[model samples]
Target: MTLEVMARCSAAAMAALAVMMAVGTDTVGQDTETVKPDERSKVSQYGIRWTFSEPRRVGRFVNGDWWVVGPATVVSVTPKPGPAPEDEVTEIKRNQFGDAAHQDDRRMRNGSMIVIKSSGRQGYDSRVKSYDPGLSVQFPRPLKPGQSLISSVSHTSLPNNNFSHKIMW
Candidate 1:
């Protein structure tokens, strides 16, 4: 190969290596913050809890930090019609990590925040003639083994207190 061509090729390879190294540095410490399968809790509604056998990662932010929590079974509560059905109640009761699972959609209970990660029947009552109310959730940190988690069923809404301002000309 010609000297100039070899120099250009070498420069291109160096540039590629530099890019890879930059990305590698960004992910260097990610594994330590990651939640292992055993570190994740077996969370279920009605207070059933356990750890996962396979490691799982949940959410990832735009900056690349991952949600360090379980990829276990997450059941979300859906809006129920008048005279809530048994299955509806059961689904809500099964969302052990509702608070962590529903952080994105702002699903709340009492004064606490609850969010769901799954949608469709995974988080709602199929029999209810209602729109889907599932949410996308993201947990803040890794959960310990056998950690106790619960879903929030009671929903509280802010009262409409917007007052109109009058402009006098």
Candidate 2:
């Protein structure tokens, strides 16, 4: 088509779009509205804000599993270093953590203990039933071009495993 015809068609399309938009929103918006954030995700399992430091690509695993596996640090917004036990170490409390590591355990701002548990295969929570510890060379899930291994989504096991063992005096 000629340039003049193309320009007329474009102008006509724009005019039609404007008309549709005007017709769609007869009931407009309010001037002011109160907004609030989601309360569910406000705090992490540690009873405080926590996140993984920006992980850099160091290289993949030998078996071709992960693209990177370098030293990742846990940055605690409010790192509460638990007081060293002056008294003799009693029966190391396993109730406050997922794994039975006393030395790696620390308390939170809300007096809740945070235990560091190493993830087993591919971030699969070891405590759960049927988990792949990252490297899945054996039972590889058959995925399409746009598909992925859903079971491969490994989330770090939260301290106390979402249950509280707080003893009330």
How many collisions per candidate?
7, 6
Question: In terms of lDDT, which candidate is strongest?
Answer: 1
Q: Write the per-residue lDDT of candidate 1 for residues 2-103, one digit (tens) a residue.
A: 222212111111000000011122233755653222233232222222233444433333443223243233322222112233332222111344421122
| Model 2 ranges with Cα > 4 A deviation | 1-31, 34-42, 45-48, 52-124, 135-169
Q: How accurate is candidate 1 locally (lDDT)?
A: 0.24
User: 21-89, model 2: which lDDT tens digit per residue?
Assistant: 112332335765433212121123222332225432222224432221213223332222222234423
Give the lowest summed-lDDT range of ten residues in model 1: 11-20
Q: Report lDDT (Cα) of residue 103, candidate 2.
A: 28
State each model's CA lDDT, in order: 0.24, 0.23
Model 2 poorest 10 in a row by lDDT: 11-20
The global Cα lDDT (0 to 1) of model 2 is: 0.23
